[model samples]
Target chain A: MTVHAPSLRQEWQIGPFRKGDIIAGLLGFLVLIGLAAGVGRLFAGMGATTSLTDAYPWGIWIGFDFALIAFSGVGFTIAAVVHILHLHQFQPLLRPSILAGLFGYVAVLMLLLLDLGRPDRFYNFLLFYNMHSPLFEICWCVLLYTTVLVLEVSPDLLANLPWKWPLRLVYRLMTPVTIIGITLSTLHQSTLGTLYLNMPHRLHPLWYTPILPVLFYISSILAGLSLGIIAYKIAMAVRGQKENPAIAIGLGKGIVAVALLYLLIRVGEVIYAGELPLLLTWTPLNRLWLGEILFCSLIPIVLWATPSLRRQPWVHWVAPLSALLGVGMNRFNATLAAQSAPTSAFYSPSLLEWFSTLGIVAAGMLLWYLAVRFVMGSAVKLGYEQH
Target chain B: MTTTQSELSRRDLIKGMGCGVAALMLSSAMVAHPELAHASDGEESDSAWGILIDLTRCTGCQSCALACKETNDRPNPNQTPIGLDTDAYSFVEEKQIENSVGQTESVYVKHQCMNCLHPACVSACTVGALRKTPEGPVVYDADKCIGCRYCQYACPFGVPAYEWENPLGLIHKCQMCADRLAEGESPACVAACPNGALRFGNRKQLLAQAHAQITSNPGRYVDKVYGEYEVGGTSVLYLSPVPFSFLGFPELGDEPNPRYAEAVMKQTPAIALTVASVVTALHLFMQRRQQVNGEATVHITSQKPGDEL
Candidate 1:
């Protein structure tokens, strides 16, 4: 049954200040200061604020961008499930997830701007289209997808507005908008992996394969599913509600299903590349590479694969958390460490690099919190108010 | 105590260390890979220009490296172009090779962008920032560059250098002194070479000359002429006494780097349309199911569906 506003508002439970939120808030302020200083350092042109050299020009910005995009990326996929598949049971998850994706892409653009050598010339990508370059494709997709996200999430705002007839028209045309959104999401998400395709020899053998775009696309899907479980828990915590066991089990099943596919491709690619020897290789870099795969991937798959095990409340957070961390680590390993390993010296983020990274993350958190609390609070209020 | 913790600063310690670590990392790179920092002394010629470096005749004088650096206005002549923050368009590497008789021979090979006949960097540059000249130099236009660094990744020879320290951060690479070639000047390094090791002329003439030399003096040169069939034939040819890999060249076959991405990307439009159409059909099918289910529920309730829905 469609829920009304008054009862839906009562369904939300506002929680008291938790220990985690207080620490996060305090650290947020510190990172804000650091971010300011880092931006100044960047503009002054007086110093190099990052350990980014020619060999490895990317860092936390590019790496964490992939992770965060995955975290909020399940929106269109969820939208497809509810509106297109007519599985109205999951409709409650759709709007909040789309809003999350919108916020995530905005943050991605800002971080990418800062990462560029000439931050001023970023608009040049629109003017100069390199058809062969994946970066070019990603640039276009991000622009188009952000617009798609706005359209997809705007129906929530329309309901509150005075204009009822226009809202009805928008609501009617939503399937096409959703169709566009899903297509764009799949494109840019996979195109992110294409950036690595040009650097075949530079990228490590374990991660490098012709099907990297496929791996990136699949892993993002699984990661998006994994992050959904966590995001729901957070939203519920904010609204002072308890998580249902059924939802937790369902999310776990989703993770296991997608993760198994990812694992098959990952393992198959390793065997095909004949790079299984890298795991046995005694180098510390190889060990770190092997460790990322073992902890983030193999272990989480084990935990989520069993239905009995997934019923536990801990699996709600644990499996998804591990998947997020694993995919994040894989991205960082592939982009940052692998690129730097061939260099004469190792790469690590500098003081300013750490500062800027933390600042951006904190800023994103603050923005997401505000957007959830104010702009899209009604999403979580839907479907269970009267019950 | 909480206020005191808030007042604490982690600034001064990090600022000093940040600079120190950057310096240390960069310095270690120079020490660990001086060869990477080594400047190439290859010659640039106008009208189908190419260089042939005879490894057998060459004495590793490094005058070519020095002269090339001086001509190009490199701030540091000693450093390798491959090193981070280097502006050198040239590089020369010294490597040891073992003969059949177990005699270890030290070989000095000049290294730079191969300036391929069909350069990958040219195709990789979306903005037309990089292009191969008819005169044989693969050049970079800083004004057109967005600093995506695709060229650096695309180059099989690893010749392009990024200006990491600069705020502008444009890519720097060997342009084969196109300006000097335009003025009808021979390349500084080739002109400066005292040992007669470096040969600068038309690419075809250089190739023919290289083949003639190899055929005449089989013992003096390897049976192969590098750059003749490598990565679709580079403008810069090599006649070496030892294998090219011994002098730090990657064993790239005749295939270009752009072909790798092209094969996949060519299928993109078809794949995209197929996926869209398929997903759309599935969506319509699912919505039809919902409509059918709703009709079934209305039949049971016996109150017409419009009022209840």
Candidate 2:
């Protein structure tokens, strides 16, 4: 019997990028740009381009951008659990986790710039330090965290480099920088949700709690882990590598644990807030809350908890995707859905807004594709070296 | 000699028990009135800047809103004329409340920056874009703003509006007409109020006036002044015959908004550091264990086992 030992140096040849990949990426970027331009032209001066009113001030830009970025917390959390926690068996999953985190945060930054009425004035945040503002805290923490992420990911580049001096410098800086990055990421990830704590009146009672910041912090850890698992499965499929059953099972267990905890906390919050009565109310807010809890939290937990179901290669993909979807739904509910109560003027997003959001996401995907191809190389190679 | 002994015995017992009870009472009083004991040796004026809005007197005419726009030179909501947008420094919202008679009454509540003593927007802004002026107004500086709009999310009132339409839109909100205040003039809305619905004055004076109004007309107003204790007290105060919630006002407790965000910022770093340190220690331990085992651990194996590359 010929046994094939997995080796990093072996090159698996996939067919050349067909015309489709380039055209799709290019077209997606173009469509994104075109939508942005349209927003500039038609709604450039009109404040009405968004569904936001005095009643519902934040719309998709904030809901999607902030939530997605917070969800990306999976990167650092997984890296910490695997590298710092000494889960060597989870090593194969680390690179993709970092990559997802990088992409998620980059996307958030881009969306922030795009969402701003004046993207250029963003430097003022750095120039003027408002020690008191939660925004100021978010700005500094996010900036420092992004820099840390780059540094944390730099060791990968260093490991691949031919020279010794640069790699040595990176190695020396790696532990401290990684530690700092984890710290910064934790601060901003939770701060993003805490940013809304003051808006006790604006946020629906079901979503608003003094403990929201802590909840956000905990949820992001779970969300990040789930994202890492999903990214790994996708990478495996793309590379045609056979699934490692142990890692998959480990991730499944981790996600189930997080899901259960998240659900319990969410339930506890609602009960404490006396918002349990809201669940019975036949309102859109109640429906959204139900959907987030049911689809994102409950279903994913059940799927991941069962060992036989979790071992299936298809389950590996489904579990993470479901978990992420649940994360997305919860974030959206918190930011947009609950805020869209009927009492306020209804805000329906404009086409321009939709296209701009889509464009930003596509740009993120494009960046991810390029980074993976040029910087990280093939999944198999990235996996072996990192291990 | 017998009479003297009896008197001495009673007097000695009284003195000992009396001192113990007095000591307990004194300590309890100090605990209850620590502030009184710490009160200044010299008298100081209780001066605070505040605003008082009489909702019953307000007609919902939106004259104050128009005055605010004109004074601030804010753009018109409908047109793209040079600089005007919905950047009104102040505006009035009409909230419909059903009375006991089941009749809908529209109450015009003016909305602007609350200028809290401990403003959440001020704390939420990392770049010092939003500031609580020492004089009491929570002001915003566009030049210093990173356009994070965290102030928008952090504000319990939802006061700050982002210029989502402009390529250079900074956070635009009411600055309590800080420029006018510096000139010793009242805010545009206060001057434009036809019924004296808006009053701007030192916070102590405003609170006094608000309390007097409620006291003088017990049946005419709600007993509570809205901003006196809400979110650590705002410069803006409101009096409503109807409940504050019915006037499009949110019910918030007295705790400062920044406390929540601050709590997270305080605890996260320690937790993250602990996790990172543990991971590093484990990595070192595993590597050392492999070394001690004297067996070459397979950290990485290439696809082509024979090929060096």
lDDT per prediction? Answer: 0.67, 0.67
TM-score against native, each model: 0.82, 0.79
lDDT measured at residue B147 in model 1 versus the true structure, 0 to 100? 72
Off by over 4 Å in 1: A1-24, A44-47, A158-173, A280-292, A295-297, A340-343, A377-387, B1-49, B61-63, B70-86, B93-106, B123-128, B180-188, B295-309
lDDT of 2 by residue, A1-387 (tens): 258854543433443665436745785776578457445634453264555554555678777877777667877877776645546677767766777778777877876766655565766665654433446567766777777777656654755555646655654455445555666666677776777775665678888888887778777887788787776765554444565777878877877787888889889989987878788869877887787787667877887898778777787777777777777877887777666342446778776667767776666666655554445443234342333
Leading candidate by TM-score: 1
lDDT of 1 by residue, B115-224 (tens): 88767777666465777777888888887787767677667677777877677678887677788889988777788789988888898899889999989986888788
Task: State how far residue B122 of model 2 sits from its true place (Å).
Answer: 2.0
In the range A172-196, model 1's lDDT, one tens digit per residue, is 4555566666666777788777767
The DockQ score of candidate 2 comes to: 0.19
For model 2, residues B1-309, the per-residue Cα lDDT tens digits are 123535644643453344334334422321312222111112223564677999999997788888888888876733222211246767677778898789998787787778777777776665666666666777777667755566766777766776656555567788888888889888888988999999989988899889999999978898989989887788899999987766656777877666665555445435444544444445455644654676433333222222111
Model 2 reproduces a share of the real contacts of 0.43
Cα deviation in Å at residue B246, candidate 2?
5.1
Residue B92, model 1, lDDT: 63
